[model samples]
Target chain A: MQVTVTTRTRSSSIAGYAAIALIVIGLALPAFASRSLIQDLFFILTMLTLAQLWNLIAGYGGMVSVGQQAFVGIGAYAMFAGVILWGMDPVPAILLGGVAGFLLAIPMAFFAFRLQGAYFAIGTWVIAEVTRLIIAQWKTLGGGTGTSLPREATSDIMGVEAIAQLFGLRDAAARDVLAYWLALLLAVGTMAAIYALLRSRTGLALAAVRDNDNAAQSVGVDARRVKWMVFLAAATMTGLVGALIYVQTARISPDAAFSVTTWTAYVIFIAVIGGIGRLEGPILGVLVFWGLQTAFSDYGSWYLLALGLIAIAVMLLAPRGLWGLIADRWGIALFPVQRRLILEGTRHG
Target chain B: MIWLDTVVQGVLLGGLYALFAAGLSLVFGIMRLVNLAHGDLIVASAFLILIVVETLGLNPFLAALVAAPALFALGWALQRFVLNRVLGKDILPPLLVTFGLSVALQNGMLELFSADSQRIAAGPLESASIDLGIVTVGTMPLLTFASAVLVIFLLNRLFYSTALGRAFRATSDDAVTASLMGINPKSVFAIATGLAMVIVTIAALYLGMRANFDPSVGPARLIYAFEAVIIGGLGSLWGTLIGGAIIGVAQTVGAQLNPEWQILAGHLAFLVVLILRPRGLFPRAVD
Candidate 1:
């Protein structure tokens, strides 16, 4: 951190504050906007959160996990169990889903951690499929058909609609607005957490592991444990976002829950296009991706094909991704994680 | 008596799965690339055989022979031009690109063939069967099983007994180092994919004869293939054979107990294998 904290930096801080304010305004927009528009925005933000979580693991950590959807599925099924069966409240139940997903990830982390590189990707996918098969026949949890979340789980708090109203989010005219606001908050929180985590000692170790596992382990870094922890963390975050996705939609099914489609294709596309290693890459990737999806939604598989073509083009032309290229060319540091020495020379405190 | 018949049918059915897994194993063993598009490539070859069969009115085997060379060329070009570029230090690039290719192929096939499921009409031979006292098995299945064994045997011979196969092993061990030893890494990969495509053509022949296939069937077939590979281990070719047998047996046995268990039982066996030996039953020394 530059100790001088330039006027430009101050202005940027103010810009961030303004951005938060705009989100707060958006949260209260239920009183103003159309129902459908808000709903679409909600979906976008939810997807943004999911993509961002993936970006952290695969992009920054350099752990390309094709099976984050497993955590997502676990999260959704956890919601089903917590809200539908255990009678937990909606908000708390979502948290429970996250926790359950974390617990599941821990054991999975132990097993899957043994596999390196592409093998790990396959391990994660296989684990997700196994979980799907188990839950598909559980009978109590809706089997392959799926089960519904009680509206009470996601609706008003303590039996009153006003509870949602208190946070400047009312579902009556704008469930989309409420959903958007929630997604915004989650996305921001995820960003902040990633930012903070990346700045930590362990984060440096994780980065080192990504650069070269043997090199990282040479100096007493337990690369395996660090990788496992990162995997678990990724699983937990993915699970939380997944719970939010299903909670917003109010339903869960084995196919939809465990759909690897929901996780990899877009996230990988977004992360790559936006530039993988940087924090801002996924954000840029999501906006561009959703924009394309919005435009090409009607073309069905053609849209998917276009996405694939673009990903291939990107990999060939600009492997560093969009924002990554920007960061390299412009020497810009929006969310700077690297240490830079100050001219002041007194530690810039 | 009927139970014995079903079991025999299941054993033969497992043979087809073994065929599916064989090509997949060859590719994976030589090049660690997963080839997410493998199933589609299989289907695509089947369509090629179908077209040749219809066009020349040639026998199905001759059509396959005609198509195999063309498929080999196509696969060689794909590996050389596209896949070879992405094979490097990071595995994700190949995975992502292949996944993209998978999507593209599925869409392309849908556009050309429509969504209708198809089977190559193998004419009267499809109904031909051999009865061995306790039970009878379709000629196609018997041929499929025999061919699977033959394919595996040939692959083994190639791997253990040939100069080209030795070059393949050497390349798999270390691409750069092998380059120092006069092996062209790119050509090796291209030939390997080409060889795998020949195997893919074999798989397509059996798949077209025995089951309905559309573009989407590739992914499901991929799942079975993947399960077989995992059950067998990462790199050992022979392990893939046993893996195919286990899945085939599990599914058939499960179906014998109850029909719904066909798919589920195989999945359960996969899970059981993973729990017991995450490295698979016969993990390769290197992997």
Candidate 2:
């Protein structure tokens, strides 16, 4: 009980400091950071959000979904409708896009959740494709051509041209700035939410479920419910990221919105390499991944092949992930969720 | 009458969908590894066949035969070397590994083949059609549908009647137990993946024969196969046929109603089925 009290106090203090830091940084990012840096950060933030959300489901909840792109697409299209059709402001519309994803997920989860394990993973992909086809068929959205945001909505928050000149990015400036900052905030928010969830009782339940579903169920944990809840949460958050992605690019083609390659390929790679089921792994992973992309992206298509090889090597050599290895090696936990329960000797008891 | 034609064509088209899904179902049924590379492998096979046909001036169908054995070997090697290491109590490793592999394969193919779309030119067979009493059906599609049915039919026989099926099912049921019986679980998995590759080769035959394909087409094919597998039920071969038919009918009929409705129609059908029967049309495998 004493330990619990100490931990709680410590956690609250950390949360407080983190919140303050974030608020300060959030406000300052637009002003302090160059547009190019902001843009790069935004893209990283988007990946962070996705990795965190995926980490929650696959890492904590034991659902290794390959279909997070489904929610991403749903969110994008919803935003498209809100902005292009209803003329809603992009920010609020983006939130609504998340709700739209949530709604879509309700029906999606029903189909996917029926099967456990691999079926669940495949079910999510199938669901995403279904959404894609449905969206693609809706002709007004540009059909196979895919839809782009109306020019007014995105053509230019895009102070990149002005900012890019500062950093020597002649043309890609506005794009770099808008995309970068947006990605950064979203990623931070996702990580914060996931960290919070892991610390909460619900997070414990999810971890329990991941460790052993039967055991979790025996302990009065509704394993299925936890899975569903997290699934929905992950979907909603990911879908929202999808919105920000297209908003930055000013495009929402079914192919782009539902592109599995974007998330499934590298998000999984990042999380796996950073370490699955471990907090801070994805952060490390995203850093490493982007670093590799920057260094090796010139390999063009072979870059994917190399990434695949690296991921496989990492999975075999370090299944615990890079962060997992660090933690295991040093007994460190940056975002530790485990409780410190004290036990007395049986004889003393 | 036109609607009748559409319905018939959809049923026939369902056969192709079934073939696309059969190997996927087989792999999942045995070991719950959702091969993200499954569809891409099909595209890879098509490319292989295209190369063979284009270079050798052989019939596309004949080239498929040559490619099948090679794909099976490729699948065998991949499983024996790469995949076997990843199968585990933890599912994410395999999924991620495969996801990475899928990306690698796509980009690898792109680098080697470039992004230009290629079709396996089939000469007169490409244009051939059979006039049924109600409507005319393309000979190639009808053949594709028939091949799908035939593949499923044979697979069903193998699963129920053959010793190999027993090995596959037993391994799927309890890999540890199967090992105790002296069955090499790893070999079983390798064979299963190889067998799936063979099925993929068949799917490739039609995919190449029917339309133009590029390196990027694999993931989309994977989606179709995945949907069919789920809609049909995870492990049921025949159910995959029905699932494919549902998707096919929805797409064609939706297109019939409004040319723009084709894609939407397919997605709506999948969504509707998912909502109504989340367990799918036939669920033979369990988590």
Candidate 3:
């Protein structure tokens, strides 16, 4: 008899092929898609990236942070400081944002880790508030009022010039295209990274730690280290995404950049509505969220109210979210992370 | 003299924060649930008082009295119907649900009452002051502090003396065992939430009279209340009051140094407390 363990499933194989095709289409989308379409896609892709990173921490790491805005705002602010203060290109400045996020996560983790459960959520929020308040005091970057990326800097951005020549487009359209592409890369990269992490040995240890800290520690899993790694990684990626978002907008204000509603609340909604703890969940969630936003955003407060109600209903009725419902009903595993053992000879004999 | 006045004002300010945190402490003590929408509920109660005062031409205090029963009923139904269903070992559902409720309540209030900031009119009492030779204090602040003390005293009395208090302790300690002893944990939770809402109404009364409030102010209020609860230690009422005073003093001092550091100072103080004593100043619960 021969037995082997496999994480692959038939659905995953199909999903792999579908993902390749989607990537190909995404890369070529700028050729035929309208400017508005590109911008909308940019929004979707960046949001998807944020959702994926958030799911990695809250869903997999068992650290539900409500202060992700701290990273986002810091990243965005760092990028702006790079451009306005150091006269660096916005593209490289985005990396500065990621580094800022990573640096901020160190102290943030130190403080927030002291708290447990729901208190941890509030602690993170307090830190984010402190960050915003301090950032508002930065007089060089227009202080609390915020500043726009210089017109020359934005128009003469690195990729914008290359895209302008290659696509025969105006600077504005080219910038949008460039942002859309970066967002696509980011979204794909984040998903791939998370998927690979979940399939690794560390992933199993992470799940163990999340399920039972003492049990995992008894088995040699460094629970705190794993949590620290997850928190730092999420913060870094969230910062990168935040930088990319602001680079696209070319505007940075303390309130708008550090908005809890836009950065944290909306991201939480996307993760929760799609299906947390699964790689495919955020993809499904971002689409539903985009659709709802498009449909109801014009109604202003009513739109937010509806979203809240829907999220609550999903939590109570389907704790697993929309994808959870679909996966359970169909036994689907589009991105299967679960391992299965197969016996060759002794199956039914 | 100036420093003394600042300290006096901070102590008075602590009274309001204690009121904001008292109901939260009560509910958390009874059930491990932390309602993220707590601040929003306080804001909603304030709005309710505003409506009663406007429509019926009643004083803000009387309006709060009228709104208290309604808030109690709302809280009872909210816990019985919504929050009770989500309470269990997994903390994710309750947190997410309350977060959603917070968002919903904020937006609902926004839709109903525009974005304009509103304040409750308290006639001449708003500006009335008292002189104690050392430092003068506003009459409203004095009244608010007295109310906070009275509420905490009554709550401590009830918690220590009543059968319902025993039931709260029993459910909090072991819900399954308490159920076996003929105390319905769910009903206890509902009554507890209702009682907390009544306190929220009182907090709302003072909140409206003290400052201007808008729909968007709830989250900040929540952070303050949360900091107070954490500073005081979980499941300890007197600890919450002291926590509130600590934050209040920090804010006043910060503001005196630089107005921008007011809120930042409160947060920093909370962080310092957390660093020094992660379990809080007077932690009552083992967990």
CA shift of B109, model 1, Å: 3.3
User: Judged by lDDT against the true structure, how good is candidate 1?
Assistant: 0.77
Pairs that collide in candidate 2 are A38-A180, A39-A176, A39-A180, A42-A180, A42-A183, A42-A184, A45-A183, A160-A174, B233-B282
Candidates sorted on TM-score, descending: 3, 1, 2
lDDT of 1 by residue, B190-221 (tens): 99999989999999988987888887777667
Compute each candidate's TM-score over C-alphas: 0.89, 0.88, 0.98
Segments of candidate 1 deviating more than 4 angstroms: A1-22, A25-32, A87-89, A149-160, A163-173, A345-349, B1-11, B47-62, B111-115, B124-128, B274-285
Q: Per-residue CA lDDT of candidate 2, range B163-279, in tens?
A: 889998888888999999988989999999999999999999998888899999988777677778878886788999899999888878988998877766776787678777777
DockQ value for model 3 = 0.83
Per-candidate interface DockQ score: 0.49, 0.60, 0.83
Best by DockQ: 3
Lowest lDDT 10-residue stretch of candidate 1 chain B: B6-15
The CAPRI category of model 1 is acceptable
CAPRI quality band, candidate 2: medium
Segments of candidate 3 deviating more than 4 angstroms:
A345-349
Worst 10 residues of 3 chain B by lDDT: B278-287
| Candidates, ranked, lDDT | 3, 2, 1
